[model samples]
Structures are given as C-alpha cells and as structure tokens.
Target: MDLRVSLQALMGRSLTRAAVAASVAAGLALTGACGGGGAGGDDSLTVGLLLPGGGASRFGQFDRPLIERKLKELCPHCPAAFAATPDPAVQRQQLESMITRGVDVLIIAAVDPELLRPSVEAAHRAGIPVVAYDRLAQGPIAGYVTFDGAKVGRLQGEGLLKAMGAKARGGQIVMMNGATTDPNADWFKRGALSVLKGKVKIGKSYDTVGWRPENAFVNMKGAVAALGAGNIDGVLAANDSLAGAAVSALNATEVRPLPPITGQDADLAAVRRIVRGDQYMTVYKPYKPAADAAVEMAIALGRGKSVESIATGTVDNATTKDIPAVLLPSVSVTVGNIKDTLVKDGMYTIAQICPPQLRSACDKAGLT
Candidate 1:
C-alpha cells in the first residue's frame, strides 16, 4: 500500500485493525531500509524507558508493557531498562542515571515537561536520542508518539454537551483540569473550551495539582460547596482520575442525581463508572499503536538512522521544530458502545467490564 494511503487508513479504525496496520508499516520500514544511514540493522541497542506513573496507573497497566513487548519484537537482542515515578525531581534523576549508564536511546513520558528540558538537552549532548512518548517533553527530541490532545478534549467536550441535553443550555459546570506542569493538560483544556465557551457557564475551574485525584477531590469538594451541587449541571474533567474524584466529591456532598461528567483515558474503573451511570464518557486512545510507534522511532534513532520512514507526521515542541511525530487517533467510549469499542477492541473483556456487582446495569446496557 502507498505510505500516504496507509497513514490515512490508520485514522478512525478500530484498535485491533489500526495496530495491525501499524505493525505492517513498521515491517515495511524495516525491510525497505527507507532511511538507513546509521548503524543499520543493529538490534543490540540499549533502550531506557521512563514513565510518569506506575502501579495501576495507565502507564504501568498498559503503556509500559506494550512498549516493552513491541521493543522486544522489533529488537530481540536489545536490553531495555525501565523506571516509573510521578515526581519530577525523581524522574530527572532517573533520566540522568540512564544517561550515565549509557543507554543507546531513551523513551520518556515526562511528569513535568518544562522541568525535564535540561535533562533532555543533556541526553542530546551525550549523543543519546530521546523519543518523547505520550507526553511531549521539551528540548531536542528525535520523535514523538501520542493521541491528538485537541481531538481528545473535543470529544470530551462534545460528549459532555450531549449528556447534558437540556441542561447544556445556560447550565453551569465545573472544569476539573489537569496539572499545569503537563502541556497536554493545557492543550486538552483549550480544545474543550473551544467547544464549551459561550455555550455553557463555567462556574468553577481548577487546575488540579500534580494531576492527583486527591487534589481533584479537594477542589471538587470546594466547587460543590461554592456552586451548590444542585446548581452544577455538568463537569468537564480532564481524565478518568479527575472524573472519579469529581464523582466521589458529588456523592459525598449528597448530590442525589450525579451530573454529566467527562473523562479521558478509558480506564477500567472509568468504564465501569460509565456503565453504572456515574461518568458520562471516556476517550479511549489505543495504546498499541502509540507503543509500536515509540518503539519503532526509538530503535531507528538508537541505530543512528532517520525516523522519516516511521514517523507519519511532525510536531513542534518548545525547543525543537519539525520533530518527527506520530499522533494517533482516539475513540469516545460510553455505556452505549462499550461492547463495540472497548470489548471488541480487546482492551477489556465483557466479563471484566461487567462484573457481578454490575450485572444488572450491564444487562440493561446490553453488555450480555
């Protein structure tokens, strides 16, 4: 298939189909040696993986394993080192340690993009190419892979409006945005505001510290008290974590009928919440294509080759222009299409999403 055609096909496809297409593209890039200029076909490159969170977080539960699996499949002889931390300082130290250890390349989903700029530059100075994964890190990055932030937010915004129905007309809502440290949060907020502004009243807005659910919980509690749970008609939460927090705060404050809430990262908990009529919807960005793209870019860069063959697009960061990038598409998931989206895509099984506790709800949603 023509590369242009292949890239176009990747958009709007189911998770399983897109992943297969991406794998085929990777294979074509490898066999054709499209941009071979460095140590060609060197499979012994060492890769260091850094993530923002672990232990039940999306990074730990999905991305880390997916990246590792793709790396092994692409470069079986390569040794891969991994680390995860939510602290910016700790992540910087981990990056420096990897630099000292002389990993051939690095893949990092930075906790704080600005804070990690210096370290990313240092890695560049050390001749180690960095592949920014999920989160766009600052400095000289070889390539980037993530879902389109603006589109994700737009989906959340549109979903919230649809859920609100009659309430959307002049109704008040709380905006539970993610931490400012992450640029994607700002991107998502902007995209959502583009759709939400002038349509509904934003009564209360918060930039959740550390993107922590606890902070979100506190902010949500304050919003409930100030806005009056009865008056608040909707919530525009940045991700599933914050959405969960918002729901908890509303429940705690004795908000009888939960308002429509928006979320990203179609987490299992968030999906369950959707089934149970807690969260309105979630944005599901398939992890496999993202992981495969990152791994493909990292290997190509590690071998001192160009990523032109693997990268389907380009993105500009604070310190770099025209950086090779692969921004994948995302899906909007709700109770109405859980089986068609998440279950059919194999992100979760019917049984896993519709546990015994949610049996009745699942049946009503047609999950059975």
Candidate 2:
C-alpha cells in the first residue's frame, strides 16, 4: 500500500491502507485551506497520471514509464502514482481517487473528455491542477501536451493520395477514424478530410469508438460490404491500432496486394507492416520528444512554476480557453524515411522496431 512503490504494484496495493489516518486528515484540511496556485512547499510531491485506453499499448508501454522516470528525475524523493483504466467512467473515478489521495498535479489522457469535465472541475476545486496529455481533457486545466494531431492526419491523407498514384481520383477508399469523444480524433479526421474530400471517392466512413480495433474491424467490414472489396482502392486509418485491425479485416476477406493504407503512430507492428508493403505509411510523432515535453511540463507545474519556457504554443479544449501546450511535429513515415524519422529520433532502435521476422523486409527498406 505504499504510495512510493512502483506503479506495477498499484493494483495490488490497497488504496485505503496507503493513506494513514493522519494523512487523510491533513489532506482534507489542505483541501479547505489552499486553493491558489504557485505550488505548496517542495517538501513532498505527488503526481497522478491518468491514461485512456489499453488498445494502443503505447501509454503503458512507453508514455507512463517515461513520465514516471522523468518525474522521478525532477524530484527523486517524490511519489508518482499511476492509474490506468480504459472505461471513461472508470477513468473519472480514478482521477477522483487521485485527487482525494491529495495529488499535487494530475496528468490525464481522458477517454471521454466531455464526460470527464466534472471530475477535472472537482480537482480544480480541490486545488489540484490537471494537465491534458495526448487527448485534451476539458475544464480548468494547467497545461496540455500532445503531438500536432491535425498534421498527423494531414500526412496520412497526403500519403494515401500519393500511394493511390494514377488511380488517385478513380480509386475509392474507405476511412476508419478514431473516437469522436476525444477532440484530437476530430482534429485528425478534419485534417485528413481537408486533403481527401475533393480528391478521392470516399467510399464509406466510420468512427471507431474507444479507438478499439474490434470496432475498426467491424466498420471496415461494413465498408467492404457497402463498397465491394474490389472497388475499394485505399484506406485511411487514423492510428496504427486501427490500421492493424483494417489489415486483419482485409486479410480475412482475402484481399491481397492490398491497396495503400495509411496510419498514425509509427508503432513497431505498423513499421513492419510498412516494410512488408501491406501498410503504405504511418505518421511518426517522435515519442522521446513528446514524452520529454510532457515530463518537463509536469515537473514545472508540480513546482507551481510557469510552463511558458517549455510550451511551443497554445491549444483550446471545449471548456478551457487558450491552454499552454507543447505541440510537437509529426512526420510521414514510409519505407523511404523509416531511418530518418523513427531511427534518427531514437523512438526505437533497429533491433527494437524490426525483429528477425521482419529482417528481409527491413533489408529491403534499408533499415537493416
């Protein structure tokens, strides 16, 4: 039940046992007393991390660990508590749990941003500021950190068009998008449409809820049913997870020499898919920079200091005004730029991203 324990043990630790009777009493008093920002005394720090889904696997695999490590670096003696639940309702409950436990600052990737507003508001009322990570969480937040999602979609759209080649206009493509609950999903869809609307015949479109691969598969199957497998030319998948689902659906139907498919998040599997020529491109948002930016922002906010030095610009959530944000660039990763984007940025090493299974593909892609 020790809060100082590693995050892998959070589930095992009984939350009730960790907060001593005196600790709760003191926390309750602090809730009533201090509401203004600029941080409490630096004697101790508690940072609560709230991530959305487990489908992508990146949050737990990369983001969470990095955030925890960076926060530790900033405050070695401080406690970094983590809570990961896929359900939006569960996420709200987790945030409240963190707030009640007296977290100094919260970093959240809300599953359902709109629904989580009340929880975020409750945190603000308790003098705990929330930082929207990846997905924007509404309400009075301290800051935001994410990649340029619109640019990610734009790159996907452009890559899809390029891969469509001479069949461009005549080639019909289905679009499988991310959940509409997250504003980033909307931005991604909008950005892709900006380039794709007039150019290609959009066969069918469906938004995957919870960014679930099964949802993508079902929607893609529906698209294939409506448009006919042979008529479909390309597919624009919002992220690597959805793209993998799309690929699975296509393979199930025996759709081979697959039409160009575009995706975001240069996940290891996605990179391999590209090398194999099944997936055309993926948008590579440098994970290191994104993780570093989030860490820097969290540390700054934890210390009750201005994040202007780290913020590249600003972004708007529904309820929050111009929130300070660190927006990183996204690069289009095809076979041609695999080395330049993912490898050069140190998001993954050749061995990590390309395994023995993909050795020949890696060689062909010039990644070996």
Candidate 3:
C-alpha cells in the first residue's frame, strides 16, 4: 500500500511481463473494484480520448489501443470517441468538440499544457471532468496518470554516466531537452540535472521545439558545430526521437565511434539504434498501467465518485493544485538488459528488434 516502497521495488529490478501485470492488478485492487460505478451503470457512459499524436507514434501504437481495451473491459457499453493530433490548437478544438458533444468524461494527453488551459477550463465549466493522461494539462482536471518523470530522468542520467565510463569524469555532454511547452520536459530536465550537474560539464543545452526530431536535429547540429563533435562525450536526449536525431547529426559531422547518448521512450527504432550501437540506452515506461489508470479515473469521475481510491498520489499544475494522480514507475533499458526488461515484458520481440542487418549484432548482444 506504500506507493513509494512499491515504486522503489519496481525500479530496483528488471520487470517481466508477469511482474508488471501483477503490479497493475494490485493497484486496481486498491480501488475496490476495477469496474465500479460510472455514467449510469457504465451502460450509458460516453468517454472521449484525446492524444498528441497517432500513426506509428507511441500514442497510436500503444497508449490508444491499451486505453481502448481497458475501457471495453471496464465499461462494455461505454461508447468512446477518439482523436489525435500534434497541434495544440487542433487538440484544443477537439477538446471543445468533445465538450460540445456532452461526453460524460474526457481523457486528454495535451500537446501543449498551457495552450490547452482555456479549453480544459471550458470542459470544467461544462460539468465534464477531464482526466489528464501522460502529459499534465493545466486547469481543473479531475485526475492524472503518468510515469514518474523524475525517475525517468535519473535513469537516463545514470545510464549515460555509466556508458561514458572514464570519459564521464571530465567529459563534456550536450543536453538535448524536450520542448519548453511541456511541463514534463522541465520535470525531466530538473531530474537529470540533479544527477548530472556536479559530475559533468554541460557544453551546450537546448530546449527542442515541439519535441520534434527535425528540431532536435537542428539543435544537435548546432551543438556539434559549436562544441566540436570530437569534444562532445555524451548526449542526454529527452526521448528516442531526439536521440535518433542527435545520432544523425553526429553521423553527418563524421563523428566516428559515436558517443554515448541517453534517451526515453523505448521506441522500436530507438531499440534498433541501441542494438546497432548508435544509442546508449532508453527508459521504458510501461503504457498499459497508465492507460488503465486513466480509464478508471474517467469512469469514477463520470459517476460522480472520487478518484482517491484509484490515485496513488497528488500533483499540481500551473492552474490546479492537489490533483489526484497515479505516477507509475519506469525501467532503464540498455543492450545489456533489453531481453530482461522490454522483451520479457512483451514490449517487443527478438525478431522485431533483430533484422537481417542486425542479426550479427543481435548475436553479439546475446539477444538471439
């Protein structure tokens, strides 16, 4: 029942599929019943799912399906509407549309937390509760669900330091952080800095715009030119997309023996890059638990029930304070534990990670 202790335990070990499932089950049990109460016996409840991206993105490939599955499992008759876009304006319009549609509740992963504030306030005024999913949204949100952002950054910092080895002592690394628009980006940067500040010198730090790979590529290119590619020892990329861009930029500059890079979101491409020695490591935050928590919170809020039973903690945004929240633990993934963590947890398979070109590398990494 002690969330801190449970999260520490989860972070201390490489998680298998069964272990992750058990953790989710235990968390659900804390709420009494997984399918308890909703808009009129769950038969007439209408839910809206709003995401930041779709089609090959994490939201499209994993979070959306997992949330839909959980919604079906908990509320069989609850008809759900879905929309995804990377534009904050479009997302706000979608949120407004959902509000106009008079849905019982909404689960939104805001593209720009600040930009979506007015829309979230509108949803509140409309008497529809909004459950902030993944990214924290501003305004009177009923509940929130996401991975522990601080821990995710710490894992990346530690992983990068380990990969750097002797170079870590006097090494200069570039910090390619996420967009300034996302509060989670700041959370992650602060956490990484907590571990990285006293140890290494940050030669160039950039807040990538829109969390876009192209933007990260431009920033990394600038860093490589400013700091000299040979002088840069490591990179702390906020996510896999940025990590990939950093690698491309370094490759373009002819930086042979690519320096170690830390990344989050164990995207399939990122995993392949790890196998190919292009990236050092990535943080893997299981999506199912987050999705399940969001759905449960939406249902509970729809039925005029408190999410105290479902929420493990509380979080505050610029416009809201003491919002009930469930912050799940995340795992650090590298070539060394890819099998034990991601593969064992069914996030990916050996064949999917090891293609023909990577077959030999996979064998060397013992992923075969």
Candidate 4:
C-alpha cells in the first residue's frame, strides 16, 4: 500500500484524510538507510517515547500501548522505549538519556514544555528529530500530534452554558484552569473565555498548579469560600482530574444545589460522574488516531522520510515556525451520548461505567 494512502486510511474522517494527504505527494521517497546504533541515518532506529506522568491515566493506559503496538506493526525490529513522570526535571533528564542513547527519533509529551526546551534542543543538536506529542513543546519540533486545544475548551464552555440554562447570565461560576506551564492549558483557557467572558460572571478563577487534583481541590475550596457556595452556579474545570477535585470540594462543603461542572479527557471516572449527574460534560478526544499518528511519524522519521504526508497542517511553536502537525477534533461527551460515544468507541463498556451501586442512574440513562 502507498504510505500516503495508508496514512489517509489510518484516520476515520475524510476531512482529516484530505488535510493529511496534501503534502504526501511531494515527499513520497524514503531516504534513510538502516544500520548502526544511532540516528546517524539508519533503519535500526531506536524511537524514544517520553510521556507526561500518569496523572491523566490516558498516557500510560492508551497512548503508550497504542504507539508501541503501531510501531511494532510498522517496523518489526525498530525498538521503542517509553518513560513517564510528573516532574519536569525528571522528564528532561529522561529525554537527555534517550538522546545519549542515540535514539533516532524522540516523541515527547512534555511535562513542562518550557523547561524541557533545552533537552529538546539537545536532541536537535544531536541530529535526532523530536516529535511533540499532545502538548506542543518549546523547541525545534519536527512534527506534532494532538487534538485542537481551543476547540476542546470551547466544547467544555459551550456544554457548561447549556447545562446552566437561563441561570448562565447572572450566575456566578468558578474557572478551574490547568497549569500555566502547559501551552495547551492556555489555549483551553482562551477558548473557554471566548465563550464565557460576556455571558457569565466569573466569580473566582484559578490556574491549578501542576494540573494536580489536590491543588485543584484546594483552589475550589478557596473559590467556594471567597464567592460563597450559593453565589457559585457552575465550574469550568479544564479536565476531568480538576472536575473531580471541584466535585469533591463541593460535596465536602455541603454546598446546596451542586452547580454544573465541565471537564475534558473523558476519563472513566469523569464519565461515571456524568452518569451520576455530578459532571455536566467532558471532551472526548479519540486516542487511536493521535497515538497512531505519533507512531507513524516516528517510524517515518526513523526511516529518514519526511512527515509532511502525515501531518495535516503546520503549527508554530515558541522557537520553531511552520512545524508539521496533526490536529484531531474532539467530541463532547455527556450523559446523553455515553452510549454512542464511549461505549460505541469501545473506550469503556456499560458494565465498567455503570457499577451495581449506580444501576438506577444507568437505567435512567438507558446504559443498561
């Protein structure tokens, strides 16, 4: 099969296929040779995949396996090593080690993109092309794969407003944003603000440090105290982890009439929360295409082939301009589409989400 045709078929949507195949026609020939321990041009490529910590669960549970499996399928002997941690410095060290080990390509989901710049630059200096995964790292990135961050935020904001109904205008809501270090977090905040700034009163807003649930819990508690439980009508949590924290704070404070909360990542627990009427909605980014693209890009880069064929568009990073990228679309998952979205996608089974204790909620939502 033509690499270009295979790349197009890897994704589900025709629009995505069209966007990705545009540049493939120009870069059809494979140029790299195979031999040796280094990226000094060889197919014996060692691909290093560095992911952000297991806080979100998706990185380890889905992205890692999917990328590894796809790499095996694409290149039989090409080895892929993986690592993850919450600390930025630790991740940077890991990247440096991968570079020292002479991996041909590096795919990184930066723990802190800004702090990780030096290591990424080191990889570039060592002639190893780095592919920024999920979050756009600040460096000379050759390729990137992620869903539209701003769009994800817009979905969350729009869902929150719809859930709030008429109370959205005068109602007060807390904004629980992700860590400032993450570029995507800012994108999400900007997108959410685009929709929410004029429509509702932002009673209290916080940039959750480290994207940590404990930090979010503390921030939510402070928001409730500063704004008063009654004044707050909703919460715009950047992701499911933060949403869970906000819900915990609300429940612990015994706040009357829990407000609608928005989340991203569509975590299993978050989906369950939606079924139990605790969370309003979550943005479901299909993991397959993103992971598959990363692997395909890695293999291609390892084989000394251009990734223009795989990347749908070009994105500018802090230090790089016109970096090839694959930006996937995100879907809004609410109780209404739990069956069609998560279940249909095989992300989770009804039995997994609807526990025996929550059988009644599941029945009401028709998840049985």
lDDT against the true structure, per candidate, is: 0.84, 0.77, 0.83, 0.82
Model 3, runs deviating above 4 Å: 1-41
| Deviation (Å) of 336 in candidate 2 | 1.6
Error of 1 at 322 (Å): 0.6
Question: Which pairs of residues collide in candidate 1?
Answer: none
Task: Identify the superior model by lDDT, candidate 1 or candidate 4.
Answer: 1
Candidate 3 positional error at 52, Å: 0.4
2 versus 4: better lDDT goes to: 4
Counted clashes in each candidate structure = 0, 0, 0, 1
Clashes of 2: 0
Model 4 gets an lDDT of 0.82
In candidate 4, the residue pairs with backbone N, CA or C atoms under 3 Å apart (3 or more residues apart, or in different chains) clash, namely 34-43
| lDDT tens readout by residue for model 2, 84-146 | 767787677677767767788888889998899998999999888788898877789988777
**Global fold similarity of model 1 (TM-score):** 0.90
Give the per-residue lDDT of model 1 (tens digit) for 233-286. Answer: 999999999999999999999997999999999999999999999999999999
Write candidate 4's Cα lDDT for 85-191 as tens digits: 77787677777766666778888999899899998988889888889999988889898888888788899889999999998887889999999888888889988
Better of 3 and 4 by lDDT: 3
Candidate order, lDDT descending = 1, 3, 4, 2
